[model samples]
Target: MSRVAPLAPPWSKQDADGINRWGHPDRTYEPLLLVRCLQRHPALTAKLRALGEALYVDATLPPRLRTIAILRICALLECAYEWGGQAAFWGPIAGVSEAECDALVTGADVGWSAEERTLISAVDELEATGSWTEQTWTALGGNLTDEQRMELLIAVGWYRTICTLCNGMDLPVEGWMRPWPG
Candidate 1:
């Protein structure tokens, strides 16, 4: 069971519109425990929904680069719910091979090119120190455009927030999705 049980019944009805908006396109929130919990607060849910669309759904970062940062954050935080769903759905579409997704669980440096490795390193630094070191900043500058660099930082911060929510709420992975590396 989740540490924080999702809202039920009348509470759910309280934010039906918000629920419909943020809920799955198929009208199912069974797998998205975070949305279930957030639905209780309609205003907050809308804000979160917009933020999510901006970060992941309508992101400007290359699909591969975005997935790499997201998966790295998921792995770092051990947010299996996020990792499982993202790896299964977005990873392949974003050009991250199954092997690469599996390897992300070990560390960001595994099986990635120098540029990608540096991107992962940036995530690590941000998670650890809340900012990238000067060395990593320089390495990243060589490969990423100012826009991509900004997107990378935003993506890292966003995914880490998601990791916190999933971990804190104990959101369950959907039945159809499996965590990376089994």
Candidate 2:
């Protein structure tokens, strides 16, 4: 059971506004458990939503690279809620294969390109040390523009924060989401 019960639908006008404002504008609102949990603090939710938009919509980082970093981070953090959601929804759309997703979890050598390997390595380093080594930074610079590097760093931090919230709450995977791959 989730430590904090997610607010159910048939929401108040205030909640509907918050959800609409923070959620992906392109997708129909579905009262995701995470969103409902955040609704408890509407103001903070709004702030987080803005940052989320910046990372997801406005950032210079390529969507495929961003999704890869997110998947690696979620796997490293063992946040099944975020991991499963990203793997099921964004992974295929972003061209991240099932084998790659499993490799992120298992640290298998899955024939990622050199750039992709560097990205995964960077995420692993960040999770382990909270800072990138000089070599990883240099490798990242070779593959990503300055703006993209900055965005990647922020994305890592952002997803880590999300993982913390989901894991701390023991949030259940949505029924529509794929659970952690065995």
Candidate 3:
């Protein structure tokens, strides 16, 4: 993972009216997730950061549902870094136990809730064939609140975009960049 000098103005902790890098991992002096995150256009950076916070923190959607969607997305994309990042959340935040995460690791054993099954099946159908089946939508019971719906779509799109960037950039997985020989 070779480091590149910034091609544009770097946001200081002084940026964002004082929120600093912790509030914005992309604004950190170094790239936190994807190398492209460091070089992303300012507008996209803000949107991605907002989506990151929404996906991980806001809980506008049920954490379990959001995490499950992310897991399925990461698996679909074969984005190992994204999967590693998303998988770490199965316990502390999503209330999903290690046993469930283990089962999902194989996919053949997803043993999901009725709602979780509907969401994952929809995501899979959409990813594979570019749309959800009518039956899949019918099974999408009214479990998600309205706010959850908005954030969930945005969150899915957000990570999918990042997955594209990270893979296209050939960004090393986080630990692969550590103890940098360069």
Candidate 1 TM-score, true structure as reference: 0.84
Residue by residue across 49-150, what tens digits does model 1's lDDT show? 888777756667888988988998999899888888778777777889877887888653356888788777788889899987778888888977878788
**Candidate 2: stretches off by over 4 Å:** none
Q: Candidate 3 lDDT, tens digit per residue, 1-182?
A: 52433333455543432223323343323444453444345555665666576666666677788777776676678666666555553433577655555444457564677787778877787678865565765565367654665566676777788777766665555652212111
lDDT of 2 by residue, 1-182 (tens): 68887777788998888877754555543657887888888889888888988887787888789999999999999998988878877788789888888788888888999899889989999999999988999999997988898899899999999999999999988876767878
Model 2: colliding residue pairs:
none
Ranking by lDDT: 2, 1, 3
Q: Can you give the TM-score per candidate against the true fold?
A: 0.84, 0.93, 0.70
Ordered by TM-score, highest first, the candidates read: 2, 1, 3
Judged by TM-score relative to the true structure, which candidate is superior, 2 or 3?
2
Q: How does candidate 1 score on lDDT? A: 0.77
Stretches > 4 Å off in candidate 3: 2-31, 56-59, 145-147, 176-182
1 or 2, greater by TM-score:
2
RMSD per model, one decimal: 2.8, 1.5, 5.6
Q: Candidate 2: minimum summed lDDT over ten consecutive residues — where? A: 22-31
Cα-based lDDT for every prediction: 0.77, 0.85, 0.59
Name the candidate that leads on lDDT. Answer: 2
